[model samples]
Target: MAPHDLIEVKNLTVSYEEAKLPVLDGLNLSLSKGETTLLLGPSGSGKSTLMYSLNGLYPEELDGKLTGERFYRERPYEAFNPGELSRRIGVVFQDPESQFCMLTVEDEVAFGLENLDTPPDVIAAKVDWALELVGLSDVKEATITALSGGMKQKLALACILAMDPELIILDEPTSLLDPHSRQAFVETVISLQQEKGFGLLIIEHNLDEWLAYVDRCLLMNRNGKLFYDGSLAQGFREHYETIQREGIWVPRLFRTAYQLMERGIIDDRKEFPMELEAISPHITHGFFTKKVSYSSGIPHLSLENVTYKHIIHPLTSTIHKGEWVAIVGANGAGKTTLSLLLAGLKAPSGGTVTLNGNRLKEYRSESLWQEVGYVFQNPEHQFVVDTVFEEVAFGLRLQDLPETEVKERTETMLEHYGLAAHKDRHPYTLSQGQKRRLSIATMMVENQGLLVLDEPTFGQDEHSAQEIITLLQQRQQEGATLVMVTHDMELVDQHADRVLVMENGTLAFDGSPEELWKKGKRWLAHHQLQQPFRVRLEQAQKKGAAAIESARA
Candidate 1:
């Protein structure tokens, strides 16, 4: 290994005992010091499997046969003593909940230091420095239970940073974060990398935020082969077609610029904006619009001055039959609490919640679920059945449907969600994306009048996300109401007819996306949101016009 190279892998192949082929095939890669590398691949492309191997958790700790030479800091990977890698390497898991092992932020950060036998004074100082680095010093004594989703993620990072690792591996860190929180987390990581000079290996599905910071890009083919490794821009530009075909995520801005180049709206020689600072010159006023009209009738579900004890403030909303609604907000903005109340999973602590003109309390639990389907924010929360097929079939069997009909519908739903092959496998054994599909499929088997889903497309790939959206659209057309809680603004723009923007446990804005967005970019920013590129481009055009007109006057 070169002096500058932090880690290197050559001819790595990972295989399971039951499978004929390897999951990762003859991969070769390297990471340089103080640089951020983005790993791109479709779901089930062995990204997580590769990540597992990096932090010394593979072959011995986790299941898999590892064959290939790997070096960490000029030393063979196998040469490291067991558990000693924890001092040299740090990992922030995809689910922040799984990474926490302490009750307070300070303790969480100090846990690793104590494990390494650092002096108490040194541990305390390191904890303070790590929390301060992540801008969470003020919350050092805060309880883990009180921290928001974003705060928990920061705490997780603080704990890792306290260890002072040379290399940091993050697995889809932004998958569960809201727009503003995601920006904060990524910016913090970037700042620390520049400050401390540690190498970064990130596995993320969303690329829009990381475009500017990524120094190198690695693309894995659908067959688990290392397809491309090069400079970020050229790799994206060269592999655009393959990326699209393999369901790999490309930034929306990149696609937007590509479309404009195709239409001759922009010169091909002009550089596209890789960073936020360069986006203004490329802005245009084209906007995608859609109109949605509700059918004439009473709302299928209504929350009249609904309040969930201290968790949610009194907020009123209504969902008309067949109308698809989306809820977006910062993390801990009462979205999940509101979803629970609407779905009848939790009784409102104040005010009234009604469905079909009857109070939620009046409906029988069995009948209420039959008419209302709920998909949780955490897919694991809903899994009670042992296997994937049994999980989906649970709802059908509840209504006492014919066994023949139940089998037919269950199999069809499984096939539709691309889980037919894993039907016999335990639901817990599936990937995060696959688990999300099972959650949706189970609810979809029965034709419920109302469905409330929290982050429906959480871990899905581009294609799987589209498939899930298509399923929801079909249900909407068939006269079902959809209330989705999401941080994905692009999804809201394309699918939701109306958007409910919540801030601080209360309804801040509720209207059509176009109407709410008309107040412009600053307005969205105040709500901890950045508009989609098209919306921002339109806003930029308007701002440019106003500046020119004022100058003439």
Candidate 2:
């Protein structure tokens, strides 16, 4: 056992029940004390499984067969029980709802301490500290049901943080959160790592948010094998081409800087800027040039003075065709509710929702399905069929389409979206990313003019996300409209035609992505939204220019 290594995994292999192929194969990884490692890989790459194995959830709660060596703090894998593993390595799952054990937030945070038989007073103090650390002190007594998705996620983090584990493993912690909550949660984790110097291992696809904060980056292949492991700088430089080929989202500024280097726009051989603010000036100086323009089309969906309420607060907004608009804000900001009303899934508590100049209520649910397709955030919640083909063909079946047409459309969608190989697989057996793709593919089968996608890219890898985005863009090119309710600002910058900023249930800003970036930092910060890394690099360049001017003066 190495004294410096907190976790030593060698020749590790894991597979689920009834599956012949191992998800993770002969994998090796090591984590040292006070080091933060970012884990990156595509969906079904065993990143989540690796995290589960590290936290002792495999073979116990997961019903999987495990093999090979897994040593935690010098203890063998079989030697430690769930309680013992929980004490040393605290885990925060991707979905907060899955982790909740207690009804109230405070009680949930106290469960681990109580299990350890800590004194009541000590447990209470720790709970309070954890809540404060995650910025959830105000909601200490809130019920789990009362908290929004972001609040629930934050509460889950607090529950683990209260235990004060030596190593914290987060498996896609920000995937389900809103923009504001995701920002706050990431900041909280980074602050804790800097202040306490704990061993942090994170499996996440949103690398742009954590690149500056991470100490090291680990790349894994499809089979849960380590491809590269080293400092963040070295990983970015040495694996730049390979990483891009894998469709991973490198820092936006890095991509921009790399483009400049390729075009002979910049002669400097320096490395790309890691931080967003550091690269802003170069972008402002016009290192690269591209203009994005929106088509001149009539509004496909309009809500004129439209107002809706969920018991108390009201939400108002409008959208146009061929518009990739993102609805972003903190949790409980009515983003989901607004999406429902717009999609005609739920009738507005008040006001009118018009599609093609006709009231939504006049259209039957069946008819609305052809005009506007809505994909819920949780794919499992909307799934009705047992098999993937049936799931995607369900709507066509409902429409009484011929079996041949149904099969044709379903197979085409599956093939286009990279799910053709899994067309016969059970929906439950699919990975999180696979399920998300299936759900979106199901909606894509319908040639709707307006598509309402709620967190469409949630739980997806860079490759899956790009595939989904390209599908949406194809729809838009075919005269379909897109309204995406998401927390991912990078997705917005890369794909959106316009941005809709929501705060406290009202539309705060509706404009172009670049215009949103120009609207002052306070606006972005208030909504917990971040500018794209490329935009931040531009700002950094402007600052650098100012510094140079001062030096010349």
Candidate 3:
């Protein structure tokens, strides 16, 4: 360890009891003050294990055995208590909603300081300062329930900032945030880290946007072994071939440039472009320009003037059979609630939801769940079993099929979703991404007709995300209709055949992704969604072509 190192680990190994091999094996790592590092690893490759160990929660809090030493400023890692650790190393989780236990932003931010027995004056001052630094001072008193998903995450950051930790460990912080909100957050965190001079360690699956701010990169193998630790650009360039195989999310810009170069679409390129701006100039204008088709079928489910406890104001829409529909809205805009109503989880205060021309409430519980499946925003909420295998098998077994058939189907789904290796592991012990896969697999095992998923790809690496998407595509082909509530415009553009947009508690727009693009910037902003990158790029290319045409004329 260097004298200037903020944290250092020497010859660390972490292995869960149920597993045959170590998740992390003889790994050594170090971080310096004011340095920002992005840690990349496969979904269950002990990335979360390393982060948990950093904050002194390891074999002590989880079922794992650790060897060797970890040092914080040359001190023993376990020397500090929980309160002391909170003041030194802070963490923000993937789901901000899970971390929040308070009503208002001010109260939540101050909750941490108050627990440390900070004086009233100091707590008040720190809370105010933290909120101001995160640009949430005006909404400090705002109710947490009313904040958008992005705003909730910002509040989570403010809560962490209030304690003034030297190192902020963010685990998939932007997975649930919209593009604009995510961009704003990355900028804010970087600016604050630069201004305040602190160390940053971010574990993210969404890799492209973060490239602009991350200074260093730590690449982990499929087995969680540290393969490369160096400058971001050097690591990206060195491991270009093996990254996808290791389940890493290669930056879209880099991937596109590499594909173009390999296929002779773009000539005279000696090296890959890692940034979007750099790659845009080299690509042909219409390379990624493709339109999604939207066609109407018989209405499988219809909502007529549905109202959900004053949150969704007399909203009406129809979901067609075999349709991939995306429900997009800002936080608190009734996306989840409306989905719940559609699933028959909650009764509408003012209208009827009809499925197959019959009222949804008229069906039996068993029949209803088989017809309308809902996956929650937080995967852990739906977990009922202890082990990964049983969690998925529980649904299959409920229908009382043959035991061998159940086992075969369960194992097949497990392997399909990359949970076969950890079949015996506890559900709660899995990484966020692993848990999400389990949840979706559990719901899909029965082949429910209507699949309502919220942030289905949250916490997933690019490879795993693609696999899940493939599964969804399979479901679509099987005549199962899917309704997805997501802030990821890219997912909507790629998967959704139709989009149902809720704005200000009403159905503001209903059409295809192409239509959403033509809705203009201000209209999208009014609904709190950024156009997908490909959509924006296509628009820019069209404008450039139009300008050239005018000049030629």
What Cα-based lDDT does every candidate model obtain?
Answer: 0.83, 0.80, 0.83
**Candidate 1 on 1-553: residue-level lDDT in tens?**
7889988999989987645678899999988889899998987788888887887888776555899988988798889988777677788886677878888889888888999999999998999898987778888898998877666777888899888899998888887778877887899899988998999999998778888799988999867899999877777677777988888877877776666667777776665556432444555444345545554455888888888878789889887888889888887788888988999999988899989999998999899998899998778899998999999999899899999999999999999998997898889878788899999999999989999999998878887888898898888888899999988888887778788998988999999877766756677777777676656666566677788799999
- Model 1: lDDT of residue 537: 60
- Report the lDDT of model 3 for residue 453: 92
Per-residue lDDT of candidate 3, residues 1-553 (tens digit): 7887889998889987777899888889998889999999888778878887887767577676898799999998878765466578888877788778888889999888888889999998999888887667878789998786667777888899887788999988887776666777788889889888889999988776787777789999878689999877777667877787888888766677677777776653355655455555555746774543433497999999999776889978889988999999776677888888988988999999999899998999988987888888889889998899899989878788999999999999999999898899889878788889999999989999889998898888888899999998888887889999898888888788999888767898899888997898888877878887776655655666687799999
**TM-score result, candidate 2:** 0.92
> Stretches of candidate 3 above 4 Å error?
78-83, 97-105, 132-151, 265-271, 274-277, 289-296, 540-553
Q: Compared to the true structure, candidate 3 yields what TM-score?
A: 0.92
Question: How does candidate 3 score on lDDT?
Answer: 0.83
Mind giving the per-residue lDDT tens digits that candidate 2 earns over 1-553?
Answer: 6798899999999987756688898888889878889988878888888888887877687767789898877888789765688787888887778888889989999998898899999998999999998778988888898777677778888888888888999888887776566666788898887787789998887665677678888887776678898887677767788887765657665677677667666653666666555445445345545534344467678776566654324444557767778887777677887888889888776777889889999998778888988888778878998899999999999889999999999999998777887887889788878888998998899888889999998888777888888888878877788899988877787778888777777888888888998877787887777776557666667778799899999
Lowest summed lDDT over 10 consecutive residues: which window, candidate 2? 309-318
Highest lDDT: give the candidate number: 1
Give per-model TM-scores.
0.93, 0.92, 0.92
Q: Cα lDDT of model 2 overall?
A: 0.80
